[model samples]
Target chain A: MADFNASDLTCLRGERLVFGGLSFAAKSGDAIMLRGRNGAGKSSLLRVMAGLLAPRSGALCWNGENIADDRAAHQSRLQYLGHQDAIKPVLSVRDNLRLWGQLRGVSQLDAVIDAALHALDIHHLARITGRYLSSGQKRRTALARILIGQSDLWLLDEPTVGLDRESCAELSQLIADFRATGGIVIYSTHIDLDVKNPNILDLDDFAIPMVEWLTEHADLNDDTNDSANMQHSVSPQEAVQ
Target chain B: MSGFMAVLQRDLRLALRQGADSVMVVAFFIVTTTLFPFGVGPEANILARIASGVIWVSALLAAMLSLERIFQADFEDGTLELLALSPVSMEMLVLGKVLAHWLTTGLPLIIAAPLMAVMLNMDQSGFVTLMIAMLLGTPALSLIGAIGAALILGARRGGVLVSLLVLPLYIPILIFGAGAVEAAQLGMSATEHLQIMGAILLLTLAATPFATAHAVRLAIE
Candidate 1:
């Protein structure tokens, strides 16, 4: 069982302190739900944990050592599925997944790709290029790579947006399978996911200081307090809860 | 090694599938080289005098035309994030992409340069030197341009910005590539010019991968 821990993490996004004093820990077979309104720093927090964004202050420990000591080793064990689907428009569905598997350094590819495509129910669309796939299909194609790669930690950001009901259930089962196999899963969503019980880490609690900082300066800006977690894409104002 | 080859193969496949980008690069090289004869004159001596310069300049522009897209497609589609997280180091990843760019963009320009030289009525003695200079010089263009492309990721006017950023660095290659041909025409060995271009190529091969990889990480952040 692998151990993953993040302690006293503060994300300094752009020029502002997006979130602060955040911490979460999980071992294999654990799933932590990142609950927060938009810019309450859910996505940014995921990026930081994914090693894409640098935390202003904190420690990310994997197994027993700090990730910074051996980032490639840490990254090799993780897969980050961000807001974008990461599909190549010109490549066939199979080629896209195949390339991803190759980049992950996975050998014996045929079995893995077949299993992944089957898990996402995209095996039938294997020959189609990305340009012709519908939005939902693209999402499924993107998710399929996760199965092929079999990363230890999956940092998914709102993965169910374009999935249909059946597809959503399929994804839930896939994640459930991943967890049952002792993989650690972390995700962000506005609505509930159909996983078994999950550990919830509300980013709002960590964002208290930035909200305070905003309010302190709201005296001059006036509008900063009105829409507290103002952000586009997911419209984070509702995340202040 | 497989990771590097994986990226190289994937990019080559994408280049083949899209087709238009590669075609446009070759087209620009041909069109730009031909326009020079019209701008100056059709006189054989004049064309020969300017052939090496025109071909080298056009090749640089052609390589730049596709430079911004080397990482742009991957960056836009979020594949760059995945690449960053891969077991491969960022430096290797950058080098892989640069080599891939050379195959799709620089290789095509190299194939077209000799023909363009003939079109410009370049002296027969200069042909070998012109090809040698371009073969050595174009990789450096792709490598150096990788840094500019990586820097301007997601910028609003990335095309123009890459030109401003990359053109100055490209001047040295242009000078040496044309100078090699000029030396050959004057019945002198172009060895020194070719040697310096090789130095620039080796330096960029060692250096730009690290710089471009750094810029890519920053852009992703």
Candidate 2:
């Protein structure tokens, strides 16, 4: 089964502390939602988890193996869909999806792309140039790429951003089905997602104090003193609450 | 390799769909070359003497005109990020783009330079040498321009910045390309200059991809 564990993950953007000393794990068949306000580093945390962004300090492992040590192997099983759609405006929807599937070494990409477009209700638009597609259609096209791939982990950043109400409902159901198939999904958004038994990580409550402390002592050396500072800053009540 | 072919195929498909883009690049080359004669007057000796330099400069500008789109469109639309995240190394990705650029712009210029040479009343030997030099040199132009293209991604006024960053690096190509034709005009074998251009092409084909890949990553970051 696929599982990801991030231990003591601390991320800093210049002097601003995004997240610090955070930990989380998601096993196969699990869906986790990352909730926070706009500048709360939810996207940053997702990037760090995907191994696309490096953390200031800590480790990220996939299936008990360090992602840093085996990046290619880890990346093979992971698919990250960021805020941008990543489609080539000059190419047709069919070409874009086929190219992505081919690059990822997936066989029968045509059938897979067809299925994905059908699922997204965009099969008729396959021959159209991506530049001509509506914003929501383009978003659905991008999402189709993720759906067609056989990745174990899906790191979706606002997967439902431009979807219509029916499309949004369809995607929510797709996420549920993916989890039911024993795939792991970790997504970040400002909107509340309707998922079954989601392990919600509310960045607002758990993140502010940690980020504030990290911002203050960002220059502290990686020694016992830093740990002492962390302990002194967070009392027992603050730790749990 | 399949990865290389995949990238090449994708780029070609995009270029074909945007037919006017490639056509405009070739038209720019011809128009720019035509402007020199009008500016310098219809003096055969002067035009013939400066023909090699004018043709080479026009070719360089044409190549530069197309370089920004080598990765900018892809990068802006997030396709570059997907390429970077793919199993294929960025170096290979750069190589694929360089080859595609050469096929689209550089090869056409080489084929069309002779027509421009005839129009300028260039000597037969000089025309042959000019075509050979362009064939050897334009690939190097495309390869080196990839690094510039990758670096200028997301920069303010990126089109102007791309030329500013790339023009200086193109000096060597211009020198060798023009030198070969001049050598031929002087009745000397242009083989040595052609060899030098080929050497630069080889070195760039080996190294520019890695540098371009790093620059692209920095741009994304």
Candidate 3:
């Protein structure tokens, strides 16, 4: 069964501490919902899990192997849908899907693209340019890429964003079906997703030691006489503004 | 290999659907070449003398026009991230797109150069040399341009930035390309210039893609 594990992870974006000392695991037929307010680093955490961004300190493993050791092999069994649609406007819908399948080494690319388009309800627009599609249509086309190959793990960041109710419901069912087939899904969203026994990881619970450290350092600097001199060196009118 | 073919096919399909873009690029090449004669006062001697350099420069600019779109669309749509995440090395992906770019833009210019040469009053030998020079040089332009494209993926004024960054790197190609036609025009063997252009193409083919891939990764980050 497909599974992913993250251990003692710490991530930082410049001086801001997004999350630290966090750990999570997702297994076959399991769905993980990462919930947090904006700027809580939900997306950053997702990127780390996807191996797109490296954590300052941690280990991400797939199955029983360290993902870093066999990155290509681990990546092959996974599909990630990020915040953007990632469609090429100049390309027709069918050609886009065909390329995705072919790149992943999926056999019978035409059949795979056809199946994906049919599933996404965009079969009629297969020959249309991506630039001409609506926002929702573009999102569906991006979703079609996930359906092209047989990936065991799916990392979807706001997959339902910009989708209509019907489309959202369709996507929910698709994720459900994938889980039922023993595929692993880790998705992040602000809205509630109606799924059974969902495991929730709230980023708010993760501590940001880096932020505290920066604040403390600033406080120490403020107590020094040089700090007053530096602040005073600025013209009064300039400082006031 | 399948990964390479997939990228090649995807880019080619995109170019084909755009329909007028490739044609327009070739048209730009011809129109720009034609402008030099009128601008320089319809002197056949002057036209013949400057034909090689004029054609090479025009071809360079036309090829640059399309390079920005090569990775910009993919990067915006998140396909670049997926491609990077794919099992195929980013270098191979870059190479595939570069090959496709040459097929669409570079090949057409090479094919259309002869007609432009005729219009410019270029010598027959110079016309053949111009075609051969473009055939050798334009792929290097496309390959080197990929690095600029990837570097400026989400930057403000990316189109202008791509040209500014790439045009300087294109000088070696320009020198050899124009040199070949000039040698042929002067009744000297153009083989040395052709060899130089071919070497530049080989070096770019080996190095530029990795640099492009790195630039793309940084841009995405």
- Give the candidate number with the greatest TM-score: 1
Query: Where in model 1 is the C-alpha error above 4 Å?
Result: A211-241
lDDT of 1 by residue, B1-221 (tens): 78888888988898888889888999999999989978998999999888888898999999988997789988998889888988888888788888989998888888888899888988889989988998999999999999999999989999999999999999999999999999998899999999999999999998888999999999999
lDDT score of residue A222 within candidate 2 = 42
Q: With candidate 2 superimposed using the best TM-score fit, by how many Å does residue B7's alpha carbon deviate from the native?
A: 1.7
DockQ of all predictions against the true structure, Cα-based: 0.78, 0.54, 0.68
Per-residue alpha-carbon lDDT of model 2 for A28-106, expressed as tens digits? 9998898888877888887777666788889998888888887666666778889999877788899889888877888
- State the local distance difference test value for candidate 3: 0.85
Which runs in model 2 stand beyond 4 Å of their true positions?
A206-241
Would you list the clashing residue pairs of candidate 3? A86-B77, A86-B78
Worst lDDT 10-window in candidate 1 chain A = A225-234
> Candidate 2, overall lDDT?
0.85
State every prediction's TM-score relative to the real structure: 0.93, 0.91, 0.89
Q: Report lDDT per candidate.
A: 0.87, 0.85, 0.85
Candidate topping DockQ: 1
CA shift of A165, model 1, Å = 1.0
Task: Give the C-alpha miss distance for residue A108 in model 2, angstroms.
Answer: 1.5
Where does candidate 3 stray beyond 4 Å? A14-16, A89-92, A117-133, A207-210, A215-241
lDDT of 3 by residue, A75-175 (tens): 78888999988777777888767777877888888888888888889999999987899999999998888998888988899988888888888888889
Instruction: Report how far residue B58 has shifted in candidate 3, in Å.
Output: 1.5
lDDT for each residue of candidate 2 in B31-104, tens digit (9 for 90 to 100):
99999999999889888999999999999999998999799888887788777777777788788888988898
Clashing pairs in 1: A37-A239, A38-A236
